[model samples]
Target: MVSAARTATETRTTTRTEARRAPDIVAGVADADKLTDEIAATSVDPRLWTGAFATNVWGGRFAIDGVLGEGAQGTTFQGTDLKTGGRVAVKVFDVGRAKDWKALQLFDREADTLKSVDHPGIPKLLDVIVDQETGARALVRTLVPGESLAAEVKSRGPLSEAALWSVIVDVTDVLGALHGRSSPIVHRDLKPANLIRRPDGKVCLVDFGGVGRMRESAGSTVVGTFGYMAPEQLYGAQTPATDMYAFGATLLTLATAKEPEELPRQGLSIDVEAAAAKLSPQLRALLTKLTAPDPSGRPADAKALLAELHAIADAKDRPAAEPSWPEPMVDSPFAARGTDGDFLVGIVGVVFGVLGVVGAIIVGQLLIPLVLTIIAATADGAQKERILAARARVVEAAKVAQRSFERSAQHGARKLESASERERDRAEHRRRRKRELKRHWKDEERRLKQLAKDAKRSARRDGRFWV
Candidate 1:
């Protein structure tokens, strides 16, 4: 009777374990259900929220229970502010030992500084809290609805003129708002990585982890990002002009994929600096101030810098129409910046280097007058006919040459397209082959695992047999 009673207790214990597991399953289901319901109720765009979580700030607590993006900063985590229970970002800073203290201090200051700003492009600062046990700080701010500009550039390659102009306007607007404040906010770090593009295509500046008020001790070192820092920023004060310089550098970056890190060093072929060439003279002049090697040469504040840009844009629209030539089809776009060969006759807009028919016409503009004078000076009809004949032949030859050059260019483009397609196909094939190889390797691993399992089972059975 005692043995049977002990067996009954063991069976009851097993039943209790199963019952506990049953409640876990139910509770998990309920929790999932609650989240799903909340998501369904609050989701503005149902098509977008299949797996995305609505960052909720309930009762002052910050909750970021959603997809953490693949940014360098482990910023994509969910957390809540203890004081306010507001949803906030818990970015894990992995600063190496060399600058750990300095980095943390900067981060704290950035959060505090952000709390003073009120801009649409900027994330709203809620609070900053460091876990007492872990020392991990959650810099709480409003969740921005956008993707980083770096991601956009990577996914979409380079942007168009209109798109770039629009982004520039936004950056200017944000800068205006920040600098216009009582205490100027300097985004010491203005690079593609820190700017986000919302669904509306407007830019939002983020990651104030590097932001500072005009007075913050530029934070322990030469801290601005390379290629994006104003020349003065590299070695001097972090003033408003320094920020403008960085802003220009950032714009240069968007215009050319090549970072400003490569700019100062690249001599002559500044084709990489074509962005400089493309700008109107006023814009060119404006950039000089914004990116001046001398900080004093630049505008005193962001407001002045923005006004300069606006003035340049305005001048471009109102400038006297550039002298147009009938020969090269000269228009305002070329007139905006004078060196187009399209105005000259005999010059072909060659492989992006030579301006073709345009060059020819401008030269023809001078040559035709000379030819006319020569024809009038000579009383010989035969000489006039010869000159006219020579001109006709020259004109016909130019037409033939133009057509030939165009066909050759078209052929070259087609060839390049074909080669690019082949290369892409080869790359895709290699990728697929690698995937197959991985699958085969995985199969071999599974086979080996099965063998090890069988061997262990056999050893156990043989031990029993030996016993």
Candidate 2:
């Protein structure tokens, strides 16, 4: 009987123990379900949560949408900034696929340089990502919208003289800023492909992987496009003037719609004279000086080149010297004119007088002189009309050109404004979403606190502790 009583007590104790642990087990399961629901609700792409399992780069903050371009060292991708819903360009350098250490060196240098500079003509650095597992590095920057000059020229024929001049002005302005720095930075690889024209008609210089200082150690690995590289750049002699030579080559490429190397050469140097024969004299002269065989032959710097360009532009803008009017000979009959207008008035008076006299000379030689005067007046009037018409046409043409320029500017401004509005809307949406999430978590926390309070009260009433 004593053994049976002991077994009964043990069974009751075991039942109470399970009753106490039941709430804890249920709470743990509820938390797991809540986590799964949160993930499902918040994730735009659930696959991105898997990190390395996904094909995209940059874990969770950024997602690659498409490839922008690929070079020998790395590839650039168009990506989305998940946090802000903005677009970005991500340049990924895969260590495993790199041909040599030079690739990494260039990559790191590009990252460093981008981080240091601030310019509208240059991309703004957003983030630097290093994947420890893959040993890959990525640089995230604001994507400059537009096609490269190379692609632009390929699809559309060579740019007009006005368009080419616009490009030159924009690029040189950017180069001026870069080269004017305390420690000059040479864009060792300035080529058509590396220059992007933005939608707003501004030029953006990109691909800083090959960028270097003005003076570097000898025997440094040559870094630049073959056709656009300066003669000295081949020997690791990079300088500000080296970039000027590349700039000239790039302009030649755009002007001719052909690669620089494709053009005829003068010994080791490009035949700038032959290649630029079709360009204006001023432009041809500028190209000749820019692509000179020796660095000393080129302009000293961007500033000096700009000054020369301004001078040329000023000369073109000046009106041609008023054509010298031959002095009327002292014996010439036409010298009697007071002015063209006075001459016309006198001729009209003579016509009226001739008509009055014709009645008296009905059979005289005065008839012939009357007809001659009328013919002279008609000829003079016609010549005045022609001159007026020519002036009107010139004025109209100038107005049309001005309107074209204004229209282009307005169109670009509208596009920029539209883009900014969309960005603002996206930012507002993000803020609203963030506020909603905050409110949701607050409500969740309140519910949990109340449940805990109720559990504690129930344990006290039942004369037991809740696990």
Best-fitting candidate, measured by lDDT? Answer: 2
Q: RMSD of each candidate? A: 24.3, 25.0
Compose the digit string of candidate 2's lDDT tens values, residues 126-208.
77777665576778877888999999999998888788899888888778867888888888899999899999999889889
- Lowest lDDT block of 10, candidate 2: 21-30
Backbone clashes for every candidate come to: 34, 0
> lDDT per residue, candidate 1, 1-467, as tens digits?
99999999989865654332111111112264454454344312332211111123322344444434433233444445444444455444433321457676677667666666556687766545443432444455666667787777777766555666788778887887677778777778888888889888789887776666665233445657866776555553577766787766666666655577665434421233355566545555655566666667778776786667655554453315432312213323333224433223212223422344444444443466457657756747777777767767666666665566565545545544544454444345445656877996799689768866864574464332221
Who wins the TM-score comparison? 2
lDDT of 1 at 221: 53
TM-score of 2: 0.57
Q: Estimate each model's TM-score.
A: 0.50, 0.57
- With candidate 2 superimposed using the best TM-score fit, by how many Å does residue 50's alpha carbon deviate from the native? 9.2
In order, candidate lDDTs are: 0.56, 0.69
Model 1: worst 10 consecutive residues (lDDT sum): 21-30
